[model samples]
Target: MLTKNRAASFWNGVRMRTLAASPDPDEPPRMVTVPADWDQDAGAAFAAMAPGTGRASLADASMLWVGPLADHPQASHGLATRLLDLLLRRAAAPLPAVWHGLRGSAPGFVLNLAAFAQPEGGLEIDDFVQACETLAEAMHLLQPSGQTPCSLLLSNLDACLAALGLDYDSDPARAVAACLCALATTAMHPHSVPSRPGASAGSVPPASPVPGLTRFALARWQEAALRGRRSGRSPTHELLPETGPIETGLTAPGHALASWTDALLGVEACGAAPLFSPLRPDGRLAASTLARLAARGMSPEAALAASLAGNPVVAIAGPAATETMHRAITPFLDRAPEAPTEVQAPMRAAAGGGRRELPARRSGFTQKATVGGHAIYLRTGEYEDGRLGELSIAPARGSPVQRGLLEAVSQAVSLGLQHGVPLESYVETFAYARLGPGGAVEGDEAVGSATSTLDYVFRTLAHAYLGRSLPDQPQNAVPAEEPDDALLPLDLPRETHRPSGPRRRHGLRLVG
Candidate 1:
């Protein structure tokens, strides 16, 4: 039972319907009172429910009678106070705040702020408490600032921060606040929310967990978010969790697979975070693992991807471990286990008198883009005149199969381009190729998903050097415009003239 903390006199507009513990079909039901204590027996026996403890306890828990704040967002302070009060109560225990939407054993309100997603490795109650505390810290950091994105705490973790449409030095406090508002009354478990007619919102498995929201919280969050958008301040795009449960594996918060990276690859880029796996449900990693990796070196984005999926030699030894390790990158591995060797498959048909050599003093550049939820590492070789000549696209290291194919295409394309093949000629050769768990076009919306990331990066390089823009997309679907400064380019060797020669048979290898 939630008794108002009357000692503090302020506008705490949380009006929850008293719990009516009535199972009898005849007698009128009474309400659970504030300041009332529910011992174990009372908690068990007196209850009216549509189902078990999961659904029944929460069914009549929170029938909010929101006032004008329900329609106004700038009035978020009032709303936030109300919601926070609920969390404070739930965190007190005895009467938990979030009861897993009745989907789990104990029924809880849609507002699950008291509940939190599990982190990498596993979870404990302390983790949930810390997450709420962090949420509180973030909520307080939401003021518009000109100095720094003080609230963008996880900017260095590209996979997690980027998915939320934020980066390091980009304020994500507003977005997190929006997510909290949205998740206030929604179930984290998809199975808990009613899906079919006459069916409970969350009656079975397969429910898509709504991050940071239950049904009611989502409604309040949406209302507040809309008003914020109209006022020309915080927009929905800035507040919501862009990646849903499936995209980020948030449905299973406690589980994530680990892969190992050499840590030496791209030392400059990989040296920021030791463990770069995607964020588990509550945006947490194994603290011990993070400390281990950080002490060693930065894990490059590729290694980050590998850490999530491909097994480190030391970590993988059994099927259970393999499953645990593979869980993170299941979506990225699209190659058939026993597919024919790609490098040799094209050798004969592609070797029509291979080019005598690759360009001397060619410029090499490495840039990374994330597709799906994984990072796609792209390295390019360009001619003296800044014309793109060759490219390599790959997932994280340790996946020999993917790396081999990427190497082949890069070498083949390098040879062909050196032999005078126009870069644009291969545009359609491998454009729109798709494989792996994530082919989502991350940096540039124009380059959508590619037939192969090798193709995607090469195409992207062509546009960058040629001063061309990608084909326009619908206004609504257009992504956050990438700023020029975001691209890091390297000019290898001395400048010279662009190469030209007759296209060679090796160009066949450049073809899809």
Candidate 2:
């Protein structure tokens, strides 16, 4: 297993490489080179399946790198298919490395974003819709034919797609394919199954058919039917249809197909069947499953509590059930609970400005002021006044980092006023006076000369605040009382002499 540090290093390397090789802003992203032996057949197949027109090229690969997959739907679909083929061929290997590389590499994030951005008519965006279809096909092929981890891998892929906000659940066929993959995976790991008595006995009644799906599925079938939908063979049905009678040979005698009906309904009710599972509908947890768990050892309160702990899928199904589950689990949770602590305010303030008020109030521009040899502007307002203001400062042309310090002080003042913090509070909180006058002493020459005084001030202050060494230490720490260097002029050297007049028309005479 890769350690945390190793994984972190690997990710960091991937990021750096990605940034370095990123396509130019005006160009699309190109597929980077993989090992010669790495899924050569799959890559060839992908290249062969490139869309009829608008194929991916090395010059403009970024177009596929970071946006929705649908933006270039055709290409996206082709790529996904190629990747799946490669993955399946290498399923026996430790895949996390390869998966990380593929995901962190170009085209993955870009294509996903593009696909999600254009959900409707995804085919028009890119060939990725076809790729998703291919993925479904691959998933179906893997479940019964391959090893157990295949389903887990499929789950990871589903999670990745969902995280990118793609409509994995939007396509009924694709959803069913994914659910079947998950079921097969779950079957492999019997320990993972939640206990539900009578479910295995097949005594349960078939749940009511979910509404709207029959119409939706029929409409999809019809649309495909109109497309001439590839003649010569009927497409493999990934999951049993919810509306019609199942042809899976699940019937029993005397009850008039009651057992079969119960089996079908049980799958429907538990939302466990590939096509009909409710979890497949929105990618959320099932309420019935939670209820079953509650009937077992789990309590409603405990279930809800578990759901709240980042299991949003569970939370989405039954809030009351989850709550009850949480309550039931509370006693166990209390045995080892987190310690409480005081809430400290956030380090950074909210971005943008505070809420704007109506009938804005104004305060005197200057409450108190004094001038020196080099005068600088300062604004003052009352704390109690019903107005909010901002102060910003930056280096003034030639002024050094010291200018940044002054600006920071100004910002602190404004923040104090807005929060109704007192002057003393500001001084104490910041550990420094807002505005003060001090001179450099002879023994303080280590602070550097006046030319670099600003640098010295910034370095010293930053070190005290950040508890770290500052880059490029200044030679002087003394603040210049008179801002004489506020606008230092540039000096451009003048040429000592001019070039001799053009060659004097002697070329023709010399040739003669």
Give the number of the best model, judged by TM-score. 1
RMSD of each: 25.1, 25.8
Model 2: lDDT to the true structure: 0.27
Judge candidate 1 at residue 88 and give its lDDT. Answer: 36
Model 1 C-alpha lDDT per residue in residues 1-512, reported as the tens digit of each score: 22232222122343333345443324454444221333222322224322233323222342221232234454445453444454334321111212112212221121122123233322122343343333322232222232221111111122222223222222242233223322321222112221222223212111112343234344443454345546554321132232122111111101111011111001111111212233222234433334334434545454466645743311101112212222222221111112112232365356664533324334554455665545566656555677766555556432435545665666567556755677776665654444444355675654775544644665576577665555523323433454333232343232244356632222112222
How do the residues 134-214 of candidate 2 rate in per-residue lDDT, one tens digit apiece?
A: 333333332322222121111122222222232223343233222222222222221222122212321111211223323
Clashes of 2: 53
Give all TM-scores, in the order shown.
0.25, 0.19
Name model 2 segments beyond 4 Å from true: 1-129, 137-512
